[model samples]
Target: MKIHVWNAFASNNSGSYTIVGRFPSEELAAQVAAELSEVLAAHEQWFRSPTAPRSGEGSRRETPSPLRAFAQVHSLTQGESDWADQGELRAWSTGHQVFLHDPCTLSLPDSYEEFLRVRGGKVETRIRHAHADIVSLFELRGTLPKKTKAETVRALVEELHADDGPLVTLAPFNLQPAWREGSKPGEPVLTVGAVFHDRDLATGFTAVEGLARRHGLDVTVRVSEEQDSRDSLAWLRPSHPPLKRKMFDVWLLEAGYSPKEVARRLGELRHGRYVDVPGLLKALPDTVLKRLTLSRAEQAVRFLREGGANAELRPAE
Candidate 1:
């Protein structure tokens, strides 16, 4: 097998270190990424950030934790914890690279892509490093002749990707298509709670605290003292994308407004789009509301119900 390496300066952390390749087939490349998980782990050698978050941080799982993301996954809580891994891999080049060297003028990614464009090879792979002191990534700038599978990339692989904070992290073992991920950066999130048995509030808080300590996240855990009460929820993330805001943007787009126009209008109204069905109805003057068809509003906010309870508006701590 022939091997080539290039430097990737963008993702320098252990979780950022990765093995990537373009196989003759996408399926084959995926398999190789899976198979080599173990082999790469064996080859990895470096110290990195601990898996646990810093004093107050959150968990970051773009993909599942390394064990789940790779084959023959092991863990400190599991056997074969000796595996090593540096970072995540992208089957497709991220198209982000910078060169800081003499002769760097023409030897840039634009030129590099031009070179790869000429090579007809169909497969590729790269092994990355996790050492923070190291400022370069080991990458491949070309295609591969064929796909190859090997295993062994492991380490604080998952831990490296975890968030650094004091709040408890609680990512679903299997991430749902939850609204959390796609929200705008620094978007505020509501910490809503439900009834959990004849609960001592402390139990829920303690559990959530433990989870946060274990995973570093700004998550809040709440179990209302009132049984079967839907009155308990808190706001955590500030500047968070409200469900109503998203609904409004989509609605306006369908209403034949350009995205730019919709955004401009929302800004003029101080995020007028960020409202639930009732809130939206109440906010609009009857004259304007009458002009807007129910069908159109419903289309924009899928959750627009004729009558239903909404999450209580609890003041954030």
Candidate 2:
């Protein structure tokens, strides 16, 4: 029996941690389900029951706190009957096995292929009444708000977006696919949520080199490192020779053109082989560059060839 655990949080809520996992053994799974209900009941007793006074000032402390028992699982085994004596059952006795799975459900799409494309995982979506709706369970941890269900859903979506803000710190770690081609096992790949500033980038580069790192996976960023520079270059390129050449080189690099390939392409272009800059530009689609002074027809041609224009070729029209 395999199981996966996820750590989740909600906005305006206290520590309402929910563990969602699956079991292959029906008997083991059933035992786990029963254990969960019992644990939850114990939690209610400790946290919600008005009759239950605070611990240490308590009436013999009859009901053991669920939170305390759950924390004890780290040191205790599931097969141990001591946990059952303490108000929760042992997990290992149920002949169950567990594995880690990603917790984010926001990446799931209606189609399995689309889900894989976005999330890099294989998962089956199913609906079961007996299964706890983890999000709803988390929401129920505290006092219910007066807002309607629709409003609550809206708020939850907003919270997910806010939590994802940290993903933007991964921008500089985004390496090209070619760099990941022959990666070896257990190589240090950058995790998705890593944050990178200019200082962090320098440190990360050094660290990666020192460790001989290969692949990077699931990088997310709110803003790209190249965006502002790309925009500025778009405006400056057609008016400045150095900027024009630099922009061209950036475009080539972004298009995944090697120096040899670029030289070959340029050679072809020089000999009137009609090397397709339009097609190349379309494939790469540098919007910042397209918006610059090179957008002018005559300037566009000159910028590609002679680096903007000589003063004599500057058209009056």
Clashing pairs in 2: 3-98, 78-90, 78-91, 78-92, 168-221, 168-222
Ten-residue stretch with the least lDDT total in model 1: 148-157
The candidate that achieves the highest lDDT relative to the unseen native structure: 2
lDDT assessment of candidate 1: 0.25
Candidate 2, position 258, lDDT: 45
lDDT, candidate 1, at 227: 21
> Which portions of model 2 show Cα errors greater than 4 Å?
1-18, 55-63, 66-317
Considering summed lDDT, which 10 consecutive residues are worst modelled in model 2? Answer: 132-141
Off by over 4 Å in 1: 1-26, 44-317
- The lDDT of each candidate is 0.25, 0.28
Superposed Cα RMSD, model 2: 24.8
Q: Per-residue lDDT of 1-317 in model 2, one digit per residue for the tens?
A: 98999999874422111122334553654454455456546655556556545545524355445644553553332232112222221111111221111112222112212212232222232322211111110011112233443343333222222312211121221211011111234431221112233223323222322222111121111112232222312322222111111111122323333433443444332322234555644654332121112223233343343432111122221
lDDT of 1 at 288: 18
TM-score per model over all chains: 0.18, 0.19
